[model samples]
Target: MEALLIAIKARILELAPEFLQFPLGHLLSITPVISVFAGIFALTTWIERKGLGRIQNRLGPNRVGPVGILQPVADGLKMIFKEDVVPRSADKIVHFLAPILLVIPTMLAFSVIPYGNRLVPIDLDAGILFFFAIGGSAELIVFMAGWSSRNKYAMLGAMRAIAQMISYEVPLILSSIVVIMMAGSLSLVDIVAVQTGGFWNWHVATPWGFVGFLLFLTAALAESNRSPFDIPEAESEIIAGHMTEYSGFKYALFFLAEYLGLFAMTGLAITLFLGGFHAPFPFLNWVPAPLWFFGKFAILVALFIWIRGTLPRLRMDQLMGLAWKFMIPMSLITFAAGATWHYAGKGLLAWILCTPMLLGSYVYLGTALTKGQKVSKRVYRFAD
Candidate 1:
């Protein structure tokens, strides 16, 4: 299948006119990724709305088309026609540039993710480093958006974004380092390649890998500003956070950058722990690799949407405590477990040693953290 794609690409390049060849080749390579994500971004809005509607016992955006499939189209039209408003007190130049900065880092981070076998856009030796370095710029963009808006609420939200992103980034990178250690490579393709096999061979099925994956997912939710970690943009508290002053298409661009960031992060998660595009069973190899990759990706996306629908936002203090006191320590221990497993030749004895260590840490931390918090059992009351 990879050979077929290569042949097709080469044939298309051959058919192009001389002047357009190089540019056309580059365009062909990048166009599909961009177009697919754009379409997915549109579809994701509808999916989240409808999923949340079902959770909340309401109909969401059903008027636009069948099951609200065309809602994104209507949304795009509305944003295009609406007035782009700027506050008189705002820094116009920085405000104009903020969304572009936000979206660029999100898109660039995807360049290093392995979508399938031999399907990376640009394979760099330091791809993992490149992903995190580009991703870190998102905090600066958030600050830019908030400061340029010149709103107190926006500024506060920006501060929260910085705090949350920086705190979680520690565990995020640490958890991923376990995978890097196990794979013995910093390249994303190499990471995925090491995990390829039957379902059990996947990284997440291992003792330390499972723990790392959970930590990674927790930190990822915080980093992407998804709920219940979405305190930065809590609507009840701060209108739209950094986006309070943005109107029309600019507001839409913020939303686009957000979902694009979600996609990129989820892709990275799949690459690192879920075996990228590898089939679960050897016999399932008949299915295309990209399909396998996206199938896993869709499950994780839905999981995020489900979490948003079900969980309430965390308090700022609680959020920081969770990151520093819980996730960071757990991530460090998981790295140690990975090291032990690697040295112990990943034998049954290694599993026996690490499993207890991981479980003990989780139980102890969870108990200690929730010690003073209220605990209640829900009593359901149906409408009469």
Candidate 2:
């Protein structure tokens, strides 16, 4: 990022002469760009609720406006006026700061997600690395919220929350490493550009690319704390986990942080696996780039909602086991396979389709046998 700053400064200075030449509209146009994004995020807030509502077969936010399009707006108003309540037993200072802590990292993470052609807020050379580094910031804030509450349930929730997030973060970074290796560049724009041609060019279809997509998605699911991986907030177990003591806008801060995190994760996935802002159709890249970015992103947002409705949360032990047992071993095996394939100089199509079958057969067969043994034990119990 520093190396690029030399040209960056020169370009900005070059534009400064023009900015002085025209006062109001020229400099002010940048304001609308920021507003557009903020609006987009706000719309996404609505989309998640309305979409999740439809999937779960119920009304989400109908009373506020027609089709509930203005529900987020109404909800925002309610939170703003609502009384701020902090537990009497809680530490005063940290409780005051925790909401800000939760939202700041989420805001930072979005800055690295490129929107479309040359539309990124800031494009660093180490974009993907910067992403993970910022992504981990939430765990810290989450733990703080749990600890500062000074509630027993809150403390236990914080520990569980930390454990779940930390475990999933490993596979999340490793899975993304596969993309860095394939694209040979960590910049999110460069990664998307490599998939510019069409659906086939998208990395998710290639061998290492496909495995990377699966691994990345699975890890991202955990990272976002979605169902089937949401051990932290299980009502049956942890009872809203780290945020149990929060209320009013304070609770809303954590709530918005979660949706923002989900929004960012979907955008990252689109950028990495689904070809970012490129049109799914090969020739469609010729169309304006923003359409593709929004189109793909909206589809992914729906998928995330669908997942929330369709899946059940994993047990805490099961969640832990998945990271250490399933995700870790699978990530290692996939990494090695990709490395070996690269070194062997095998054709991309051939290796991706064939390698997982040939290379992983032993492991697959052993896993099958173990499943069979479990099934037999269940049958025996039934018979007895």
Candidate 3:
């Protein structure tokens, strides 16, 4: 405990050396990061709503400010002023506790996410594992919320939540292993540093790299409850699931946790495979590092949004099957493929040797996609 305290003190001191002189100068020094992130988080929420609203051919929150510019601010006030309710049958303590519990870890998970070279607050050596460990909190607190809600729907939602997360978490971890193996360290900084030169150095360039990328992408979607994987809280079936009885600010807290989770997961994807905070292409590395990192981050987030707009939620059995039968097995195959290529000694020969397998996988996936079109056509014809 003493050692841990000392380490924490060191981190705090590192965050602001001016504290020694001005007594609270570090707060000012770190103010930009906190305020900027807070603003970004709030703004992103509004952006998502507006965009989603646009997709549905409606104006979203346009009354809050011009074009709903102050919409988040209004929403914030609404949540803050509203009376939080505990369901009559709920476990009051757990119900009250769960939303806060869910939100904190979602925010804290960003600590080790390397924003840029030297931009991180504390880039732990075990960043990848830290990310994995922290993410588990979501599953736990969500269960707490669901179980505490004292509704059968909430209970079912919580069950689905637990099952869904556990299903995807395996592939998430396995996919990350491919990265840890490639970078030879669990640190996000080290991962980025290894890919310093250009696009070719990035993991997505390899056979296992492609496999790992797709695995991480799918698992991340599952982890975040985005679209196809959003079975736990599917409105049509479960009626908000774990958060069924939460009201006002408590509901907002759940909403914030989700968006923050999306942000962190996208950042994680950037760090692990896309060369966190790196420029998109080799030639663009000449641009400032922060721009490069954030540029890539933005692209991934946009991809996530695009997907949410495009896909329908998966059925529970479909969700479970995809994880167990597909994601897990594919991730393992990817990790092995990555390791085997590295063992063959990291060069043109390694790339060449992996080419056939890569081609085969691509062909198989392509054929599968085509088969879906054929099946869909038959289904439509039969319906007609």
For each candidate, the alpha-carbon lDDT, in order, equals 0.91, 0.75, 0.80
Worst 10 residues of 1 by lDDT: 375-384
Clashes of each: 0, 1, 1
In order of lDDT, best first, we have: 1, 3, 2
Off by over 4 Å in 3: 1-34, 57-61, 281-286, 359-384
> Candidate 3, overall lDDT?
0.80
2-22 per-residue lDDT for model 3 (tens digits):
234335646777776563735
Which scores higher on TM-score, 1 or 3? 1
lDDT of 1 by residue, 1-384 (tens): 765776788899999899999898778768878889989999999999999999999988889878789999999999989999999999999999998889899988888888777888888888999999999999999999999999999998988899999999999999999999899899999998888779888999999999999999989999999999998899999988898999999999999999998899899999999999999998998888889999999999999999999999999999999998899899999998999888878889889988998999999988887789886976678833
Q: List the residue pairs that clash in candidate 3.
A: 277-293
lDDT of 1 at 363: 92
Best by TM-score: 1
- lDDT of candidate 2 over 59-115, digit per residue (tens): 777787788899888878888889888899898899889888888877777777777
Residue pairs with clashing backbones, model 2: 207-352
Candidate 2: residue 212 Cα off by (Å): 1.6
